[model samples]
Target: MEILMTVIMGEIANRSISFLIDKCSSAPKNQDERLHDLQRLLLRVNVIVEEAEGRDITNKAMLYQLNMLRKEMYRGYFIMDNFRSQANNEEKNSEDGNVSHHFTPSKLNPAKRLFFSTSDNAHGKRELQQSLYNLNNVIVDVSEFKAFLRNYPPLYRQPYSMHLFLDKSMFGRQMEMERILNFLMLPEPSAPPITKRVAVLPIVGVANTGKSTLVAHVCNNERVRNHFGKIVFITENDLKDRGLINLKDRDVVLQPNSPLNGNGQVLAIIEFSEDIDEAAWRSCLACATCLGSVVKIIITSRSEKITRFGTTEALVLNLLPLEAYWYFFKVLTFGSADPKDQPRLESVALDICKSISGSFLNAHIFSSVLRADLSTTHWCMVQATLRGIMTRNACLSYECCVNRKNPVYVRGRVTNDLFAIYPSTEISSDETVPETTLPELLLGGVRCEGKFEVLALKSRIAPYKNYTNTCEMLTPRSTKAKRHQKPR
Candidate 1:
């Protein structure tokens, strides 16, 4: 816990520093000095925290002290984050008008007071001094905790778990993999030849539906290897400050003077996150179009909203079928061995399979938890825990297409046999959504009347129009552990 908390503190500090440097660099002249000073203090604090982190501290008292310091650092980080976000927004607004020269007499916002001067709080030098002092006290005496300063390497977040794909563990995505390959490798004659030359293929689905895993699979396919002369993989971290064009042309490591081949084709696979700037996408598209080559792009995202950004929808991955899901679950738990080989666990394993719905990610997670103990007692405990989570949700189940938002009721049937259910609401086309909505279970165990403000943006594209929509209910935490989990 101490190590993970320290790592998180480091990440927060790093992000805060990067945010200030990138966003506050163009602040008003009066605010430049304050921003620079703040950045300097943060840099000092970051160095201390990093140095302390490099040393392996085993002493319990020392560990507790470090944790206390980490808490203080977290508070500082929150304040810094608030300031940077405000400044970023203000900077955008400032671009529409001329940059202000004089400091305003109006009472400054809490964040602005840190930099902007007013009659009441002149220069904010005292507050800045106090902040630096607190950071200094928290980070003081690092060498006392360790015999030597170990040169620890900087941390980098893995794009996705390699364990999922290792030892031929990936399952039930061959059809989706082929769909991406068809879009990239197979030519579209109906569309304009030029537009087809540089087309955007979007892989849209809910979170943890293996969107990244699917893209990685397609990128590693044998056919993809022969088609494109050049391929570039873009990660979320790669677009920290630069746009996509820079990432493709400048950031990516490419061979010198490697010109396009006969087809003049370049395949770029981007793992798109929700926080991605629209300008970055446009910049990348413009660069690809100007390259005079057939730039086939594959982008993976959770929201169907990205379709509004002039992208052609290629694949919408839904949950796997029961048989395929069971195969996936079996592999994750029992490896290559047959689950029936173990007579003791056969019945318990079948119950687990039935309870998990069709989420491959959840299956992998729950199976791992079950693998910890093969005894019937542990299996029953796990089963009861999962059932408790499902039964607590008060909702109504309806049959609906996975790609559509509106739920369709089955005539003369109180109970329907669908793998997934969606919340009752109308799908909207508005792309500018302010919040995200997670779905809840609608039937069985407990019942309560209610309505939810759900955000279900349905896809209108063909083939997908008939896709079976599954509700994003509570998956086992072990499935999404990486998301909520901090790196140690």
Candidate 2:
């Protein structure tokens, strides 16, 4: 996923460079210089990132910096593309206008030409320059990271499959699952009435810790199936009222054809992304409350903040124990947890499992990398790389290890020792306001505004890659200034 993201950004930069070169003749004198500088900087950074793609990037901060640079580059690319497009349209319209329309007399205004004049895109030029300058700084930071990684040479690196096969029971959280079931099944004593029988149950955890898989298990439980006659699993795209039921202020009346229309108990399994419309979600909750039958909601998200949406306390999923992780790793790698069953590979399997911090994804990938070879020498080499990555930061938890490439995730809310990474900012003055005001929609600082444009570019540039369709990152550039238009 990370490699694909960088490649998409590079493709955008490549297209933007071509666009700038083709249109430089009509652009402002200063615009071409900035564009060329940006093109050069992006090309250089692209080369560096591609070189490091196959190498293990163990540091979380360095990986974050690389992603930030990609984002800034994408923003720059779109800004340039938009400006070029506007310039082309303006020129086209000028040529197609009425021939005799309001020609300025040369004697009255000597500097005036007979043709229409285009406004100087000075604001866009400046912003373009600023974005390039910021991106250059990010490149410098990434260069420092490259230097740091140079000290640790690349180990036995292999292309690993993204898919993983594992037993759900061995992934931990049995006790937590039981707790969630109790919360969903048991009726509250202090509850107001049947009309207000709705309850929100949010399952919060970090990425790749099997949060989705765990939710799937609970949703498929036999008891849960019996309790709620009407079960609807909705994703971000299915939130519209047309396909589903319309939600009004007072009551939520389901459509006759709607699956949730009946008076039987209803269970909604909503997969919440950070960018979902808050008003729509609130309306859904209100509609549930208005529904005559008992309604239960199970929301799965990486954000701990979602817990506040539920009237009852949210359930937090913790990391699996070392024993559970071993079992998971053994089954995934050797098809069984018993080392005695596989006498030849037992020692090497234990060595690899111990080095891993209990991430099933990591184990899956590493196992593939070492799958062809059962020799002790090759196993020891792979184990050494894993240990080195882990020991780089002695105090590292599995979260940090997984976070290196795992993307943004949610943890517990702030306590005495722990503070929020993005603490709510105080709006003391208008000057203190950020340039972009929309709530963050993408996890791991990804912007979503021009996601379609980026993906469109990616598909056109490199359609041969099978996973292009799977790489869904939409975080887009900050709001741009309105385009300048000529008066009629």
Candidate 3:
């Protein structure tokens, strides 16, 4: 009796000690300390996401929370990584005897403010605080996530590094993919099956924001293919007032062999560059009904008006945040090579990314150029060229299509002449492309006269689209002639 009583007293004492320790630790940590915790939490969340990616999760609520978690993870990672990059850059600048980065505000000491300026330091603090608050709220909202996570079995670990993952899979769209896949695979049984009121999903986003790629990826999924019999692509050019009846010759058929397991319904993929009206969408659906129970209709457009047409809620995709884009671009640029090994090159790579804005095609193209030659000299040249291009028109890199807002001109290195440039239409895998790639042109190894196409980087993923810009060689706009012109 005495020993049992002693043990109970000891247990109470231990619990009390533990409780106090937990309370003290939980009491607001310092900024740097809190960031360390945030990093660990984000890594934990990343592992969970990687596991979740391989499995098909159906809980809409869970899926939504996962999206929030992934986004916060990216934000947290960005903050931490940016600080590290700044610190290293400061150290590198010191070693190279370089005065300092062209940090804004001249009154500040260049040596003292290596990592950040007064404004930057204050701004960074606020950003970190807001990030922590937002992440905490997301975690609190999804308190039961861990409990649900236990139910799903883990798949074999995928050996995908950041760069490899970016190369193979769609970056920043895993949750979106899962959401769409679940929608297609398991139709809502609550709706009468006989009516065959087929589901329509409208994917809306800005131009070149992967709206089309997402639809194509979901359509090509094995599970989705097994659920629907026929897959057809209908472009803005293919739509007729009569609806989808005459698509036999018009639309491209993706899958012909019936999987024998599916419900034997057609899956129509419609793509539009402009806003599609209510009547046109309904007509497509009406024609779909005439075709005997089209199970799914997937449409993608840049206009948000398409959202009204979805039977389910619309999925909107935007480009990654600047920090996230930098992280991705850095990985792609260094690829298998460590950024630590070449800090100067890494700094230059950031400039190149900014010059191109958020253009994914340009990201791939320039990253390829950087990776091809890891030397700082080559990277610097690329940076200067991109800067020159931006000086002409920055938006040129943003859009893959030819209808650019401002004309782009590339000056001949030797001839000192300017040539007008325009991007060509999408080139497919089987189609013939120009011999001179975009990198070749920027490198200035070869210069040709007259109009010709320069092949930009091609997609390694589905849709396999490539960009080729047309360069119209022209007589140099004679600055000498302007100099001699008399005042009007």
Candidate 4:
């Protein structure tokens, strides 16, 4: 039985070591499950050790095993510790917790402090075992040992994932964003009180138009960050499933007075796709308006028609200008400003800019694909590819305008009548017209009196085989003798 118990204890120790190694191998985010698994392995080891007759392992051996575990686990702990330290520093700079000092290290127990410190040497493990041995003989409470393990640095790393998600200082976007805090803070109109307090601004454009990028930038801007008391970003799935229900549970309600009711004014920035149904869109809009009378809900979408559904106060961002295009080009090329490459590439870039027509996303993507090649031959090839895309875009634009199911009319006049000759076709604005004299051509059509002229009846008449048939069609059922006029 003694031999069997010793074998079992050794097996448990080996298994515990294996478990610790596995936990160290994975990411810090998965530390919760790893911690639980480690605890279970340790419990098995403790059970087997207690059952063994002559297998009373020395505290030195246990400490040696712990040292091995610490070395293996230190990498993950170091990464998490560094992240936490940096996060805390940022929080302190922002005065987030109203704390004065920023560089404070977390207070930890002796074992954890030793385990985490980079200065701890191999001999320190033996010293720690000796200290524990001396403390164990005293009539002290045994609960302290459990508390020490429970408060270890490894346990601290277990909650790192939650911290990562909740850390607002870590969230950011790459582009520059404009803030309208001053505009929103303007006092309510005094004269005829405008009841429409809530406003929704839906940004619409085609795919790769930088909608999300713009939203992200605007949300992370310093002005917006400082002005709003509370800002929350809700994903599409969350909006659909809960419809701001979770937000309400968090005490974030959609009410105008509530904005001022809390600590200060709160602005909730809700982002959703254009694909959301009209009802869901309405729900999101309602939520925004509920937040405050001066609530500004900014939405990004690929459809132009989303403006008609909710609030009419929508602003469309014009596509990138030439200056912005150059800025974006420089960014994509990583500041490779060679004029030799520019002359050949400028025309192609212009054509691409015109084709994409101000979409930052498109420009960025196209530039990224081309920037991979450093050779002049690749630039030439890119020019060729851009020309093809331009041609295709022109064709698509024409098709979209011509083949629309319900064509738009202007002042009760059918506009499609002019383009009925060719369906889904477009003529360039630069095309020249054929030379022809209007009166001469019409006069040569038919003769009247002494001069060559066409009857007024023929000019205004409906479709007919010839001028005579046209005249007959217009010579109406009215018997009143209307004077017939002819060309002089």
Candidate 5:
């Protein structure tokens, strides 16, 4: 019993010393100040114990009273530090004259302080006085001592566990993913019978084409979410174990057996790689086909070849139209929509769209890079840079098409002076032709293929509506053909 009392007294002394150190660190500095404060606190504890001795306390009762006194001293020191720190910070703020008037004290910290102070005051005096009145009553039974400790309110320290709370953006993504699952499982008229129509969809496009964002948008759309039973999305460049492939397969096979059933209408959207090896492609395809007719698989990739593998049809995602690009740009620049900046923002957006030529990825990235600082000079620079890039790309595309050896042609009607023919390729008209006579060229290489005949040419005439040049070249000359003609 004496040993237990001694341990309790030691704990109280340690807590008192720690409280004094914290207070001194924050207070106006004085040499050896914390040591002096701790000595003074200990002297007060000794005085309380001496006062209890005069009331006829036995050895055991005196020890219990001393432990109680030490606990009270520690509690008082902690309260003093709390008050001193607040006073010190307020003084510093007032002296500097920089503290904001908008600031308000926290309700939680002050409430905790009041609760601790009330309990310490009630227990320390009553327990000490009762122990002195009767030696027998001074020594507490072990069970009652435990009960006292339990009944006392706990000290409120600054919490470290509050970090578990999530931010808004993370929650939004989770909600979006949930909504997409609903859309992918929706019933469709074009859907194949529950067993045969199960197919994989690979959405392939170049870099920055908004593949992830498009998937997010489709999943979030109310119409799509309501129609589908289960929509599962597999993000790109993840390993097999991370639900890149295996998790997707389980969703299709184990969940629902029929498209009409709640689980069977699983829309598995996968991401394919630009340079995926044959083994990986085969594995991905096998996983996709596991759902039979009920599964609709969609993959987004930069490689066109990846889309063609084990798939019936593919839809190419084009660049965003001008208006959509404008909306995206506005959102990126200002957190909220600003009507005053609309004209300047639109001009900048249009220039970027033309340069990227409908590439949603390019527009998104470029907009992000320029979102900050909406200055006139910055907008002008962005426009000039995009125009330069567009001009360069056009020149390169034209040159590449023109240099190819194969003759390219587009089917179009001929009329008027020039035979207008649409070229099948991007080559320039001037590069292919040695002569201006377009009609004589058309008749030279007319060849038959099965039922249809084709005319191959080195070059085609401009202004495709005109055919007068073609007619003159096809006309027979009066002197040359008659002598060679046989008597009919």
Candidate 6:
């Protein structure tokens, strides 16, 4: 009976999603001339990007070119979406007897002030000409690319809804994923492999920049699983101790599956959290032999020093540019609801994204808040608090501090040694989250008197990791004592 009921509910959900997709897809495309042109340009670029993602793009120059095209595609969309939103805002304001069609500096939210500095009216013919020229040059360079794109089959069918796509997709990572996979399934390639003495691939990025997530997806691929006899994950602790040397005895062997293919070949993934030591790296390579004949060693680290350990060129990851991140954040914030319909909310959401400092985790958490309560007042309140928090830190991001494994203040308060803090983390599906969430704490006036865990973030993307943090509360006497310790 329960199984029947569950099946019925799931079917209903599927039908509902399909109906919405049909409606959105059938809706009229942008009628405005400039938007129509931009949309067509973006569509062509999308075709190229989508095609490239499917094939094994080993050429570094080609990968770089593909990346440049992606940047321009994103920029084009950013311009299109903002233009659409502004037009909507103007029409609404004109109807409401506020026909000035101008947003004053004072009227703009903190986010708008940070990101949208140029006057909407200032986007003259000269600027338009320059943007078109840049975009055209990219498309023109990739002209041969389009002809070749048809030869390689696509990786996956395109999704109908942006909502569903963003939910399951790894944002802005298609090219990188293809490259990593190409490196992993090597030597028998249509392309070249790394040098013979056990290939090494190093991936470097700062804290919380999708390094783990990217590698996790690559390692889980069926091709990778079938190619190696054993796939082992080694952490900083594993390398520091004699963990990897005695593999089976260690507890942190992250993902262990039966050797599907008895090739007796091993692939080792080392999370080098600190600067790489040449002697220690050599020792790691030595330990790799004990597991099996090492096929490849993928080392991921926050330190650039890891590049020295790679047999091939290292893959370095960086955060998205301001405009690109805004595009991503905007999509996440406004799901089915059209941003054009709620101009006020759009302003607030933009500011909130600005304050987040490109933290993907924060994007998940705050977008949930916006989704939970889709009110302009609620959004404004959250934005004000978020902006205040950023201001108090002198714009040193809470995300960066958390990513660096440092304790950071989440609110505006001047304090000393005995102050409070929230130490954040990203948890997997098997783990449990606390009853209290970071959004409630920051926006809903939720408070607790002692140390307790709070859900800081929950990603909708694959692996669907959730983030939590420990909230430290101080007693009145302790707080007073700390404040008095400092002489003004």
Best by TM-score: 3
Report the C-alpha lDDT of model 2 over 130-248, residue by residue, as the tens digit: 87878778877776777876755453366432123242232345455666677767864555554466778887876556565666666666566656556666555556544444423
Sort by TM-score, top down from the best: 3, 6, 1, 2, 4, 5
| TM-score quality measure for candidate 2 | 0.41
Cα misplacement distance, residue 38 of candidate 3 (Å): 5.6
**Backbone collision count in every prediction?**
4, 7, 0, 7, 27, 1
Model 6 spans > 4 angstroms off: 1-40, 43-66, 81-128, 140-143, 157-160, 188-196, 239-244, 248-260, 276-283, 398-406, 411-419, 460-464, 481-488
Q: Please report the candidate that would top lDDT against the real structure.
A: 3
Which stretches of candidate 2 lie above 4 Å from their native place? 1-170, 188-194, 237-263, 273-280, 287-292, 336-347, 368-372, 384-397, 401-488
Writing each residue's lDDT as its tens digit, candidate 1 over 434-468 gives: 23222212222221123223333332221111112
How high is the lDDT of residue 190 in model 2? 56
* Residue range with the least summed lDDT across 10 consecutive positions in model 3: 105-114
Candidate 1 Cα misplacement greater than 4 A, ranges? 1-167, 187-196, 235-240, 243-245, 248-263, 275-280, 290-292, 308-313, 341-344, 388-488
* Angstrom error at residue 198, model 1: 1.0
Better of 1 and 3 by TM-score: 3
* Root mean square deviation (Cα) for candidate 1: 26.4
RMSD of each: 26.4, 28.6, 6.5, 29.6, 30.4, 14.8
Could you give candidate 4's per-residue lDDT for residues 1-488 as a string of tens digits?
99999999999999999999988975443322332333344344333322221122223333344333322222222222223333333433445555533333334432232233322334543433333333333213323333334332331223333222212211111111222333334444433334435555566655434455556545554455555555655557676577644444444433333343453345555545445677776666666555544555666665667777545455454444443444345334433354323433543444444455444334444565456665656655555554543342324342243223322111101111110111111112244322321111221232122212221111111111111101111122221232242111
Ranking by lDDT: 3, 6, 2, 1, 5, 4
Model 1 global lDDT (CA atoms, 0 to 1): 0.51
Residue-level lDDT of model 3, residues 367-420, one tens digit each, is 888888777777777777766766654355454432343346665544555666
* Candidate 3 accuracy as lDDT: 0.69
State, as a TM-score between 0 and 1, how close model 6 is to the true structure: 0.74
State TM-scores per candidate: 0.42, 0.41, 0.77, 0.36, 0.33, 0.74
How close to the true structure is residue 339 of candidate 1, measured as C-alpha lDDT? 49
Q: Candidate 5, after superposition: displacement of residue 283 in Å? A: 2.5
